[model samples]
Every structure is written in C-alpha cells, then in structure tokens.
Target: MSMPTLSAQEISSGRVVLRKAHDADRSGIIELFTDPVVRTYLGGPRPRRDVESHLDTSGIENATAKPGSYVIARNGTDRLIGTLMLARRPADRPGHVTDDRDELELSYTLRREEWGAGLAFEAAMAALRAAAAELPDQPILVVTQTANQRSLALSDRLGFRHVCVFEEFGAQQSLSVARLHSFAS
Candidate 1:
C-alpha cells in the first residue's frame, strides 16, 4: 500500500525538517550511502559507481512515494543530512512482534558530518510522531546490528525496549520496539 506524503513543517524539530527526497538530494544521498564512516554500522559503504548508476537511473520519486520515507534536511539551507523511514517489517524477516508479522520498523541514517549533533534523534522523533498519528496504537520496531553503539544508544533514548537478539546477514542483530505510549511523551 502507498503511504501519504508528510508535510515537512508539520514534523520538523528545532533544526531538522523531515520531508520527501528530491532530485537535488541524489548527490547527498549518494554521499551518505558511500561514506565509509556513515555506512560502518549499516553494512559497509556501497561502491560509488553503483550508487551513481542507481541514482542516475531509478531517481528519487520512487523512493519518496512510500509513506514514511523522509529526508532529514537543515531548515533554512535545506541541506540534506540524512534519511528516515518507518516501514513495515517484511513478514519473512526475522523480527516479528505482532500477529500480523508486518510491524512498523523505524530506520535512519545521518551523514557523518551531521553526527554528534543530535540530528538523527531529532529527525527520528519527528518521524515517529508522524507514524504515531497514522498507526495509532501500533508499535514501531528497529533492528540494528548489536555492535552499532550509536544506534543502540539512540534506540534506548527513544524508549524502544529490547525485544530479542538474532542473527541476520552473518551478524548479531538487536530487535527493539517502541509502543505508542512511549511516543505520547
């Protein structure tokens, strides 16, 4: 099912605005996905050539039409810093917390230069707020590599409780969940 587009202003925090990705953001997206430091926890960086080829062909419209996908950009300059998504966990995936087996999952990544400034946290909270509005009582999940300290810490800060640990892609993954009540605050 297709998701609605979010109003950038409605979900913005102090410095970050959550909105759809644009053609102009391709370069930034390419940069974020190709940076070794940024991709360290999410899987190693993709080849620059590969990223270029994909962006050059598939484009941003396909990526933005999905319900909860967003670009985390600076408010005034509108500089792309990261991406955030609250999507359904595939029924076939390892983490299944609800009977439907399609629980919402929160995923985010910030450019390396944007790290240490809380943009990820701010953008994530904004995205979760938007998700809570649509999903109401449904819980949102996040799966991160156990070794990704930054993401683990962010999940804790966002009030996601650890559900379980399982292996995926040859690495230990921590599946965490945050209920609607947690987002109420």
Candidate 2:
C-alpha cells in the first residue's frame, strides 16, 4: 500500500506563523536541534557535524515537501524559532487512539530562548487549527516525556487529556489526545 500525501498548508497566529520549512530555515532547524537544553527530553542533541551534513544533503527539501511539517517563524522573518510535525503514528508503536495506523501525531520543539514566552503553544495551536481543517474528526496525539513538565503542561493547556503513561526510550512517556472537533464531510 502506498502512503497518502497531505496538501501543504500555512497558518498564521498573530506574530507567529506556521508554514513549510524553507531553504533559509535549514540552518535554524539545525541550531534548534543542536541546543543541549532543547534536546534534553528528546534523545539528545545531535553532533553539529552530523546535523550540518544532513542539512547539506536532503533535509531541507524533504521537510518542505512534506505536509503537516512546519517551521515556526516570528514576525514574518526567515529565522525559524521552532518546528511542528503532524504525522501518522506508526501502527507498530505502542500508543494509538484507535486501531488505525493513520492517526495524527503532533510533535514540536522550540529554541530555549523561546521558552516561557508561549511561542510553542502559539505555533502548536496554529498547527492544530490547520489539522482540524484538513483532518477533521481525526484525533491529534501528542507524546512527550512525562518528566518534561513544560511539555506536559502545554499539552494540557492545549486541551489534550492524558490517555496513558508508559516507559519508552528509557523515559516515562505521556500519550495525550485532543479531539477538537468532528468533520462531517
């Protein structure tokens, strides 16, 4: 079976905009991933050399072409402060709102400097709106480390309720869901 493709979408929420990653965002995304504190809950920060090399290859174009993957920019600037990803959860994965493999999974990461400024929530809310518009009736799932209080709180504020908590990647992972609306189409 072939994978379905999602149409690219752009959303704006005041000074923050959710749009596709551009070539200019390549360096910023690399910087976002390489920050030690930013990657703490994530596996870990990748080596600068490795990240740079990946960007030099196919990272930018691939990211841009994929739908539901966005670079969060501020004030219409090319400087990306974070990223949002909405993807289908792998059927093999532990968390699932249903038996379907196409459930939408929401993930995001922002620069440390943007922390406590509510930028992550802004960007994510925009992405959620777009997801609701495109994939209505389908629930959005956010999986994060339970120990990451900020992320957990953000998920809660975004109206995502805890579905379950389990250990994954040697850390406690919280699987949350938000069923914003139902699409009748």
Candidate 3:
C-alpha cells in the first residue's frame, strides 16, 4: 500500500506521536546520526559536517516525502526526539526471512535522554500496530547487531523471534521476524 494513506494520527497513541520530518527538525535529525550513544550499534556516529552536508543536499523537507519515516515526538510538542522508520530491505542485503529479498523492515533510534522510559517501545508498538492493521499479512523483519542486547530484548518484547545470525558490517547480525497477520486488528 502507498504511504499517503497512513497519517500521523493513525500511528499516534498515548504520550507519543509519530509524524513526518521537516527542516525544523534539522538539529534533532542530525543528532540521531551523530550522537555517539545513539549510533553505537549502527556503525558509530558519522561526522557531523558530513551529515549536515548530506542533509543539505537531500533537504530534510524531502525526507517525509516517502512512506514510513517518522519523527518520534511528544504528544503536545513538535520537538523531535527520535526516528522510527519502516522501509523495504533491499534484496541484496545480508538478511531476509523469505527466499525473496526486500521484506518490510522496522528500525528506530531515540535520543540518549529518552532511554529507559519505554518511549521507543511505545512508539514502535504504535507504528507496528498501525502497519499491521493497514497492510496484508507477511513477515516483517528486524535485524540488529547481536551485540546489541537492548535491541535484541526489544525485538523479543515486540514479539519477533530470532531466525538466524549472519555476518554483516564486520559483526554478527541477528535477523528476527514477526508475522504481520498476528498483529492485525
């Protein structure tokens, strides 16, 4: 299904709201990629200058132009604290649940300050439930570095069972999946 049908209100629940990103979010967006704490398991933080350069070229305004990319924000504010993205896992990537590649993938990252509050869990659950309700039953994958115990735990909390572990990015990466139908309303 297309992204247009999924509105910010649809994925929003309780204290958190997931909405498309914008230029006003430049610093927050940059922080997600540059903050050492947030990027520890994601290949480390990129240089801030390079990140700014890329964002300038791509235009943060164009980010939400695609489907399933959201800024994780508090319910009463527009300030962005993190990002939750659902996108196609390219066929050429190291992980896959089906013989065919390009399965739906869920990835999220929150600012350091938001850790331990269960905000990531809350935002992710809301987004996945929304996706499950709107899309057909299929395997949705969550691939994370095996060394990331927190992420592995979160995957389990989200009902994804580990299927296999493979080498990627010079480290062992675990692939887990949850059936989309199981989450449908």
Pick the lDDT winner: 3
Q: Give per-residue CA lDDT, model 2, range 1-185, as digits (tens).
A: 32332355677887788778778887788888798999999998999998888888877867656766788889666578888887777888777777665577888888888889989888887777666665546677889998899999999988899999988899889999988463221
Error of 1 at 138 (Å): 1.2
Write down the lDDT that model 3 would get.
Answer: 0.84
Ten-residue segment with the worst summed lDDT in candidate 3?
Answer: 1-10
lDDT of 1 by residue, 84-150 (tens): 8877788887987887787778899898888888889998887777666655577788999999999
Tens-place lDDT digits, model 3, residues 87-160: 78878888997777868898999899888888889998888888878877778899999999888988899899
Clash number for every model? 0, 0, 0
> Lowest-lDDT window of 10 residues in candidate 1?
1-10
The candidate, 2 or 3, that scores higher on lDDT is 3
Q: Which candidate is the best by TM-score?
A: 3
Runs of candidate 3 with Cα error greater than 4 angstroms are 1-10
Ranked by TM-score, top first? 3, 1, 2
lDDT measured at residue 179 in model 3 versus the true structure, 0 to 100: 88
TM-score of 3: 0.92
Q: Could you tell me the lDDT of residue 50 within candidate 2?
A: 87
